[model samples]
Each structure stands twice: as structure tokens, then as C-alpha cells.
Target: MSGAPERRTRGRTSPSRLRALDAYLLHCERPLLERQDGPWGEAAFLDVGFGEHPWTTLESARRFRALNPSLRVIGVEADPGRASAAASHEEERTHFRQGGFGWAREAGQPVRLIRAMNILRQYRAEEAGAAHEELGQALLPGGLLVEGSTDGPGGITVAYLLRRGAEGLAREALLFHTDFHQGFAPRLFRDWLPVDWRRRMVPGSALHAFFAAWTAAWAEARAQGADSPADSFHEGARRLSQAWPGVSAEPWLWENGYLRWQPPTEVPRPQGL
Candidate 1:
């Protein structure tokens, strides 16, 4: 239960960020929509650490509601002032609450999805696993947990999709979003790796080698006069799949600006820390 206290910051929200996540959001929503007749008749989305603006939560609620009117979108904040400020922006099916990841249990109903962006950054790396376990307990069966952070004008972001499994929650995929023009490099994603894995980016590590290959491919594509970032990313993914055939089974499309791969069965822990 111990974690960083909520440190309030400027509320900068963009429609583009929400738009970029549209595809993944839809993918996460499908299952809940299909199971509408279950115990929790209506689907709920909890946007944890939603700042004062809560624009992302508001827009997300509006978009998802368009598909299923019964869906409820709640913006959650740990800072009381920000939560109160967000109240003014609430609409009919969308509301704001004052709490953190712990709010999940208090909901008294199953939650289908929870988005915790930039929330874990404040906590030490050792605290991430505990926070993840806590969040998993708040989900309905087969619920999805999307958590990550972004930087650089909002174009570069990395997110991990953790799906609720029979045992607990397991990381389903690792996603990356980057400005193709800037080219994909290992360093660009270093800051966004989950707290636990951030320090494990070294030789012999799956992620370190993965990014190395991506960077090499990007360089080769650019040298051959690839016109856009998408072109470079496609070439990079192709090279990556060629080197690691397992990648072929996952969604590594260039258009999504994400290279999603199944998480390793056992995540390698950082050594010599």
C-alpha cells in the first residue's frame, strides 16, 4: 500500500493522444461489450491519476459511450484539489473521483479497464510489482490494465497491456509509439520501460537486443532513402521478425506506431544493481 504521494502538476491533455490510443482502446473494449449480460451488466473504465483537466477521460468516455451507452467512465485522481477541479467537466455518464489505484475496490462493481499513465513514475522501481498486484485485484475477469508514460510533444509513448488471467494479471503485450521520422532507437524507449524492467536493458536481455535490432534496421532503411517513419518502422519490424521469429506471431504493424510482443514467460530481473 506504500507508494509515492500524488504530486500535482500542470494538466496538459491533448485530443491527439486519445486518438492515437483509439485502436488499442477498441480492442480492450470488445470483450466487455460481448459479455454485457454478465454480473456487471455495464462496462466501466477507470482512468487513474487523471489530472485536473481530465480531458483524456472525458473524451474516452464520450467515444466508448458512442459504442455502448451504458458504459461508465470514471476519472480518478489522488490529489483532492485536482479531483474537485475535474468535477466541473463531468458529463452524464462520466464522473470524477478522489482516489488512486485503491479506488478500484470501493467501486462495488467489476471494472473492465484501468488506465494508469505516468502514475508509477513517481514510485521506486521496487514498488511497481506491488502496485500492479493491487490493481489486478480490482479488475473483473479478463479485464485489461494499460499503464505507461509518454514524452516529447506527446508523440513518443510506450504502453504495456496487462490482461487479467485465471491466476492473476499477466502482461500481454509491450507497445511502443514513436515519431517514425525520428527513427526508432533503444534509448528512446528506455525511459518508458516498466519500472522493474528499466534497469534490465543490457546485453543478453531480450528488450536490449530487440531495440538494438530495431535501431539497426531503421538506420539501414533510412540509408536506402525510406521516405517516412512508417516505412522505416516496417523495415525494422521485418528485420526484427527475421532475427526473432517469435515476433511474427504478435502484432508488429507499422501503421500503429507500435511493436507489440508477447511478454516473456519469466521477465529477466536486473543484475548487479
Candidate 2:
């Protein structure tokens, strides 16, 4: 089937950046995997928009397979050239296919997770929701859909975790990562918002207010001589959580430079509306 246009970029990803994601998957699947009867039957992970050099795909597959030996990893690329290149690196349990989000349904099995890192950047902002809906339909019940991008040598990343709910697919959390020493910049977070939300990063929007608040807290912490970027980040998260009860400070924020928050459901109205 025809697919979206490819917008490839070169980057490096270290396995350490995925530690928080790994813990989350294990937590979500613990019930089934730890059941007395036995682990769930075979499960699959789809790495969408895996570019020509798919080291991230291979690394993710290896790490996830280590977590659950029964899992299969499939790299899906829209560019035929990239897909062919990815296939050259296939292992016993990992495979590659030339397709896009649409291929999620034709995988011949229910997908437990789909990672679409940096995929949405290739499409216009208006196309994000439709793309998400299409991919959502390809998930197994309770499957996860992680969509986002990384920046600054993969030390800073942002991802939105969505899960198939009874009503439909709902965003579960916003995941953030940064370098422990450098912390994160509010503007950098702005760069990571999903296509649809990127334009809403204006003065009155909640997302805008969120980063503004974070930036203020970060500045305050730095002025107070916080030991490191990690320390400043923790303080910023603390400030945000205190100001908005919806935010939470997670323990993983220290070591992994990760923080998660369940965003408010209401879409922020434009200022002066």
C-alpha cells in the first residue's frame, strides 16, 4: 500500500534513554506475564517510521525481547529504500516491512505496542489525529501507542503514551527526558509537542502555561544554586505539581531524567476568547 512521505534525519540513541519506557511496559504487562498459568501468547511490537539506519529498531527489539522472550519486533518504514535497508539487519525475531501506519492492521497478529518516534514530523499538523486514529485501530485491546521525538543527542526526549480504552484510544501520559547535568529548556519542550498541539503553545494555552511555569521554576532553582540540571528539573517538576495538581513528581526523574504527567482533558481555549 502507498504510504506517507519520508522525512529522514540522522541521530543516535542509547539504550539507557529507553529505561523508563521499558519499566512502563513491564509494569503494564506484569499481570499477564507473571500469571501463574503462564505468560500471554505471542505479542508484537511495531516500530513505525524506522528510517534507513534502524539502529533504534534493533536496539529496542533486543531490549524488549529480553523483557519478554515471546515478543516479536517489526520495523515498518514508508520509504522502500529505508525498509529494504532495515530488512538487511533483521534478526531471528525481528523483521522489516515496507508500509506505514496502515500496515499495523495487516501484521497478522495483535500488536502489543507501537512506537512512532519522529513519525509525525513528516506530516502536516492537521493530519496527526487521523494518523493516530488509524494506528490506534491496529492495536490489541489495552495496547500502547508511543509517539514522540528525541533531541540533543537523545538525552532529551518527549513522548505521548496512549492506550486503547473502552471508549477509544486516550492519551495516558506525557513522558519527558533530559540530560541529568544540562536539565531541559522550556523552549526545547515546546519543540517536542505533537503537531496538533505545537501551534497551541501560545500565552493562554495550558500547554503554553505549563512550559512557562516549568521555565520559571527552573530559573528559580538555578538561581538558588541547585547542584545539577537533574536537581533543577526535580524542583521544576515539584513546582509544577504544586501549582497544578494534575502533575506528579516521579522517582525516576532523578536517574533517568524522566517525568510523567497525566494531562488535563480540556483543550485550552485561545487567549481573549
Candidate 3:
């Protein structure tokens, strides 16, 4: 019910600074409750790599419970300090754990959704797939994993929705909006639900939306022996996988990350993305 009013700022972390995050979480949680308008006995969520942003996940969980009281939400983080803080201050229907997402064991109960924002940015660019693989290993058969990065302000952000299956990936949404930047990108996403800025990111947030198509782009580039992002990612990732068995992604992910890179050349040297 709160967080609808955005007031995010960046700098040294302060009490007021944290309030913006708390509010932002409430904002994101509103729709989630509507999406789950039923009992939670059959559904749950996993919010991975949430840093100080745990408040948002907690707010989302609270909203979900208000709608479906039985729903469960787990807030996980790699940093023990942040994890402890969030665990101590969590609201109802929330659980907190300290560990890397890769360390997630099998779930006793399946998850409906997993929000992994800004999680992979910390890794080497080429390791995106391995990052996915680490999280993928924990995903329920049909669960959706959303990935993205956003500034301290709530608005300026990009997110990709990923699904599991050997055959392909279903990207629920690859969206970008700048208004969430608070005082920053105020004009970014000043529109409606699905904000559409005239400009697009490298591959746009939707680069990973369709795996088969993305990977084919890579394979095609490799076949042509062209010097494109596709060829670079395809080859680079191949080498990485060969060196570390069972860690490769479906060709699509590498290409997706390749395209997601800013200059394409900016991707890790190995991927050449």
C-alpha cells in the first residue's frame, strides 16, 4: 500500500535513503498481490541476491500474504551482513538466508517465481550462463526467474524474465524504463504499465526473451565466421564450457548476454561479446 511515492537517492547510506528502498518494495509488491489473489498454500517466491533491497522483497511478500495468506517468500543474499539485517527486520511471511544463489539446494516445495535483480553484474561478463545454471538448478520445472539491474532510484532499470526447459526459454518480459531513477532519469519511464522509450538497449532487455532465436543468431554468426557479437559469444562461451564441463548454457544465453553487452566488444575477452 506504500512505496507508490518514489523518493530514492544515492550517496552514503542513511536512514532516509533506506526509506526509499522500503517504499520501492511496497510499490512493486502491489501488483504482485493482485497477481496472486488466492491462498498461498500452493505458491511461494524466492528473492535472490537482494542486498539492502531486501525491504522490497519483504514488502512484496507481505503484499502476497495479504492476498494469499499461505504464500511463502524467501529472501536470500550472498552477503552475511546484509542477510542478517534483513532477517532481523523482516515482516510476516518472509524468510532470510545468507548464501550465494548457486548454493541453493533442492526445494522441498516448488517456487512460482524468483526475482534475481542485479545479481549477475558482479560476475565476469562471460559467466552469465553459469550464473543462470547455478540458479537454474534450483528452479521448479515451470518457474520464472527475472533478472535485471536498476539504480538506487526505483525507475531506471532493465529486467529479463527467464524460464526453464531444455527446448527453449520463455521471456515473460524484457522491460526498460528510466523514470525509476528518482531524481535522476525522471523522464525515463514517465508513462504507463509497459513503458516504451523510443530508444533501446544493446539487445534491449528482451535480448534473452527468446532463447532459440538468440542462440541461432550466435550459431549463424559462428557459421559465417563473421566478427559479430554472436560469433564472439558463441565461441567464447564454448571455450569456457570446454574448460569447465557441464557449465554451458543453451547457445541462446551466451548470445543473449553477448547482445546485452553495451558495446558488444565490452563483454569478457573470452566471450568476445
- Please tell me which predicted candidate would have the highest TM-score against the true structure: 1
Q: 1-273, model 2: which lDDT tens digit per residue?
A: 323344555523444545545555565455433322222355568888766578777777666666566567888887787788767788787889887787868766567788887778657666676677777777766777888877635666777788887878887777776664444555666677776676666766777777777788778877887657667777767776777645756554534566677767623323432
Candidate 3 per-residue lDDT, tens place, 40-115, comes to 2445678776666466676556555655576678887766777787777665667887766544444454566677
- lDDT of all predictions, in order shown? 0.70, 0.68, 0.47
Query: What is the TM-score (0 to 1) of candidate 2?
Result: 0.83
Q: Where does model 3 exceed 4 Å of error?
A: 1-43, 90-92, 106-109, 166-173, 180-273
Q: Point out the worst 10-residue segment of candidate 1 by lDDT.
A: 244-253
Q: Kindly list the per-residue Cα lDDT of model 1 for residues 200-245, writing each as its tens digit.
A: 7878877777677767867777788765667767766666666653
Model 1 misplaced regions, further than 4 Å = 1-15, 27-29, 179-183, 219-227, 245-252, 264-273
Evaluate candidate 1 by giving its C-alpha RMSD to the native, one decimal: 2.9
The local distance difference test score of model 1 is: 0.70
Question: What lDDT, from 0 to 1, does candidate 2 have?
Answer: 0.68
